[model samples]
Target: MHPPGADTVLVRHGDLNTKSNTVKRYMEGLLAENLEAILADRSVPGEVERRWSRPLVHTTEDAVEDATAAAADTFGVVSASPCLTTSTEKDRILEVLAETARARYDGGSFAVDARRADKSLPYDSDDLAREGGAAIWEAVADEFEPEVDLDDPDLTFGVEVREDVAFVYLEKRAGPGGLPLGAQEPVIAMVSGGIDSPVAAYEAMKRGSPIVPVYVDLGPFGGIDHEARAMETVRVLSGYAPNFDMEVYRVPGGETISVLVEEMEEGRMLSMRRFFYRAAEVLAERVDAHGIVTGEAVGQKSSQTVQNLGVTSRATRLPIHRPLLTRDKADIVEQAREIGTFTESTIDAGCNRVAPDRAETNARLEPLLAAEPDDLFERAEEAARNAKLVEP
Candidate 1:
């Protein structure tokens, strides 16, 4: 068994920022108070390396072993191993092969999985695979003992080097990298036919919280056809969250919205959204959902403005989850793409189609609340009561 406090790092292919963020969120959710201690005074700093897309970061095998141990204690960590990635510096590709050999012979048997994004890498994938195999054999030499087998090793070394950093990590640790679990027991998401909401749902699911997707269909804005498209979008979302169930909340908001608009100004549209959230809260309680989720990204739109989100949030007594609240638009899109919801989200159009140009961002709560008519609250309650829930 590997000694305690072994420093192991994870090297995954693709975007480093996402991997880092995912790790941080998972750690925070799982470790809770301990996470603050881990980050505030990261005794395991050098234990985790960010090398673009590559799996291995240390130039020496000893360093890899040390990092592996420290990573194991980062909290919420099940297993920790080091990985080395190489998408750049095609010339040094053989070195990665050599390092893998060193790691294997040092202890476990390992296998190599190939990903060739940079066609210009010194050797084509097949050539590299063969060369890597040869290098492993050469490094092991006659020192190979009966106890260690080349073909079936315990460790699975991975390499993904994209852009500038050549990330290196062993397969032992794997990833605590999924969306967080149990931050909120259950929540609702105002999943529209858009990228943000799907990403939001995904984040909530990562937290291990059950999600109830609610879509509002302002018929004239986009009727049953749009509603059907939203349902199709749910089908796509299901792929990422196979174990989770999605419930579609369909609201025929045309008549209600028109009446609300005539009585209240454009700013009141946000208040109207709050009513919908309250409706979701009621449904959530019915289904034993502990909280609500929404695709509200900070500074993404008028309704997503701090004030608007706050106002809408007040309608719900349960916790409201905003997974995308602090993320950038580009980052959110990338996550949507990765989760396979990008294509479907882009195809669905909803209320934003006819949304007023001047949607408020930094709205003052007192003013907006004071401006809302009393009947508006009654209408919201009624609409929420009359809302329909579809299960998929």
Candidate 2:
């Protein structure tokens, strides 16, 4: 049994268990360090320990909620729960289970879910669950009726018996499950003021890549409002990884847009997208990033059609990762809301002033390739070099 007044939070692993032994150990170490950093950043006083192949956060009773929240928000975590630790003794387990249930469960259909990680225990999972359920029923029966519903229940009391101890918890807070951040190489994320781009960058971050957010400043075409919204969105994203200092790179892009609009009338949007990719490639080289992430979705805009996407993709050699490629606008918006970027993105950034009334949807490769500017790489290099870093 844990000391009196001590609170423990059980942190569940996400996909880290699927890796090889060596990789899993390495990632688990990183996950533990990240969890500590997240708790410290949130001003929650807690100590993290690895036990039973999982991270356990030991905190004070008052800090348990914050500690659990911090753990849940961290990458590589599937869920987090503030649990009560007790001995593996059957009677002690039932006593703690009943006490926890009486404190948390308020007269409703409930279920007892028990798991025995230690097979050495005399009782199996089913026996533990049955005994635990009966204990809880007896404890709460005096006040109100407590019906047991295995299929679906209003309240669920979970019990897990380990080698030397057991854990009793009522709720599991869901986390953004994926590999730990910094697990993959860095990537240059082409972010915009709109909802889609920020969500795209977040998905990349969730997949273990620390992103270098590049905001192309389309001068007269994209107004000050647009730049402000984009910066705010990046700031919102920076909150997710509080331990990492996310630097936003502002690239000047108005000159390139002006040139493309004048040089190609119908294919200007395609050419503009190409310019964005080319600039991202240059920034990628500067940052040693392996890929570029964008918010492009199929048929979302005139420039994002299948053929046009392929044509624009040719502008850079690096892999272009569109996390929202197949996602609908509504889904993207919902994800944006979930990630705390929707409100910042909703701020009225004026419409694209330079977009053609009827932009080319299915652009052919040969013609657009031939019209490509010879100084395109040079311009990209200049933009990348001149990019100002905004610290969040």
- Over 185-208, each residue of candidate 1 has an lDDT whose tens digit, in order, gives 767777767778877877776555
State each model's CA lDDT, in order.
Answer: 0.59, 0.85
Q: Which residue window of length 10 is worst by lDDT in model 2?
A: 1-10
The candidate that achieves the highest lDDT relative to the unseen native structure: 2
**Model 2 lDDT, full chain set:** 0.85
Give candidate 1 misplaced runs (Cα > 4 Å). Answer: 1-176, 179-184
Give lDDT tens digits, candidate 2, residues 1-392.
22224399888986998898889888888788889888887789999997636789999888888888888888888999888888999999898877876677777798988989888889999998999899989988988888999999988888878898788888788899998888999999887898888999999988889999999998888888888889888988887787776889999988887787677677777877788888899889988999999999999988899999999999899999999999999999998888799998975543356677778898997887677676766787788889999864
Provide the lDDT at 14 for model 1: 22
